[model samples]
Target: MNRRLLVAGLIGIAFAAAAYALMAPAPESTSRPNVAVAVELSPAERGSLVTRRRFAGNLEPAAEFQVAPKVGGQILEVLVDIGDSVARGDIVTRLDDAEFQQSVAQARAELAVAEARLQEAVSAANLATRRLDRIERLEARGVASASELDDASGEAQAQQATVAVTRAQRDQAEAALNSAEVRLGYTRVRADWPGEDETRLVGERMVDAGDTVAANTPLLSIVDIDQLRAVIEVPQSLYGGLAVGDPAQILPPGRPDSEALKARISRISPRFDPESRRTRVELIVDNQDRRLAAGMFVQVGLESRRVEDALIVPRAALVNRQGRQGVFTVAPDADSARFVAVEVALESDDRAALRGVESLDGPVVVLGQDQLTDGAAITRAGQAQRS
Candidate 1:
């Protein structure tokens, strides 16, 4: 019985050894990794970039002139009121001229009387001179006394003096007449400007008809709307790219979809505001259509810069690696990817301008870079090998 038991134990030990050998872990699989990949992309096509820089500003008339009276008088009539269209030399206001006309007539009469007196004095002076000449000849011939000749000369001198006095009086009278005429002319007030017509848009009436107005009193305000100015204040820290003759755009406020008007930079304030730390720029626009007005809020756009023939890439494709900027480039075999550092220059919209690329023919990964390493095998989207 002991021998039989020994044989069974030996068989059991052999079967256990065979089972352990069969259940042992198979050799480690040496299969390749299946990494998910993003699709490769190319840079966006380049064309004319209408870049714009916007700023809030105010609208104003390019040229504004204040209408006022030149002389002081009682306003008898107001021919033109506020918002009245007037031509050059149009009668805007009138003053009381009855008293002024009477004064002119009196001056004219005084001038006529002075002229008559001057003519009579001249005739008398001529007669006295002839008498003096005859007396001088008679004294030379020893026919007249020397005392008589001296008396005739004295009479001539007196007459000459009288004539001089009358002439002076006539000159004074003429000056008075001119003064009266000028004063009378002040009664008719006309628009004084060089243009063929004065463009009256808005005005303020300070006095009514029959109201007395002082010299240089502001009767009303008139502004020309044919041309307008768009003024904008820019911060000092920003680059000043606007200068005279530069192209600009003026956009009216309260309307987002309205088309912006085109204009040109015409003036720049030499003095900068100390408190606001900004400089003012003015843009001139031809508003012959009268669509723009003064004191309206607007926005100004100045295109001061442009980048041409610049290489641009998607901003999302760039990654930061140990404080260095890098992008994932597809491998030459087209089945893997590698990280390469690049230098960026400018950023606009969602694209970036970068350098350090040998060529643009290589495909670039647009996504899936967080879990990627150098030379990692990847399966691109839509490829037959992709899961």
Candidate 2:
């Protein structure tokens, strides 16, 4: 019975040991150590900040003119061709003058006939006046009857009326001749630009020798390329800041690295395009050397706004955290440099204007900012690389 009691005591000890192992708690772990992030930093600078808007545009001539014939005829000769330079009043083309010359000759012959008739009428009027005077004197002397005197007066009046009618006919003939001469002059197509010695480029030639064309048919297109217009479509958001006389920089595609041509806004469309929500703006650029040409693509940069004495940082410093746009600035700490979040005001391609953070005397994290949080530890890139 003693042996059985000892075996029961051993079993009871094993059960108590198992219960204690199941109910015991686990030990606590030590806190994670802070990690030092390597980053590039730049000091905030106080300087001027200019905001610009860029747009793609095309260069066009400031003025364009269409050369057309004023009279219908077969083209006899095309004096100017495409790419030709012409001045005001220069003859561009000529039409067949055979028909027009014939018309002019006919008009001149009619004028000559009218002049001969007028001369004949004048002679008759002079003779009738002399005869009437003689008849009146005879009647006063009682040598001629009153009937003869009346007949002489009537004849003289009739001759005078005939002279007036001939004079009217002569005037009509002269007008007809002048009109014919004017029409003949229209057969010679001439460039009629506004200013003297203003050279224009012939953009297109629509007619050739022996081609028949009607009045007002386009024969050539001329454009003044000394002054070019850079036309750009500006969105509604940026249209408000644009105004006439505002300065602009024009970069022609051909000479991208060359100095930008200085230009000014000359015109802005009063109405907006509903489909595009944009407006057209015209910038005038001087090209006296003819370096720029119409239909060339160009880039236009316009200064929209300017800020003075603003705190600026590199664009890389900006970060979006919790739906907030900000930058990480270095803050002093006893053990390491800490990152502090500062809000961004305005941003450009390479730089950003910052605001809402006091004491910008500290450095800003340019690189390695993506992994940064408020109060996170950081190390300067140079120092980290050396270590």
- Per-residue lDDT of 86-203 in model 1, one digit per residue for the tens? 6666677888889889999999999999999999999999999999999999999999999999999999999999999999999999999999999888788776665644545535
lDDT by residue for model 2 (277-332), tens: 88999999999988888999999988877766678778877788887776676654
User: Per-candidate TM vs. native?
Assistant: 0.66, 0.72
Q: Which numbered prediction scores highest in lDDT against the true structure?
A: 2
Model 1 — which ten-residue stretch has the worst lDDT?
Answer: 41-50
Judged by TM-score, which candidate is best?
2
Query: Which regions of candidate 1 fall more than 4 Å away from where they truly are?
Result: 1-47, 194-202, 238-240, 308-387
Q: How much lDDT does each candidate structure score?
A: 0.76, 0.85
Evaluated against the true structure, the overall lDDT of model 2 is: 0.85
Error of 2 at 369 (Å): 11
Overall local distance difference test of candidate 1? 0.76
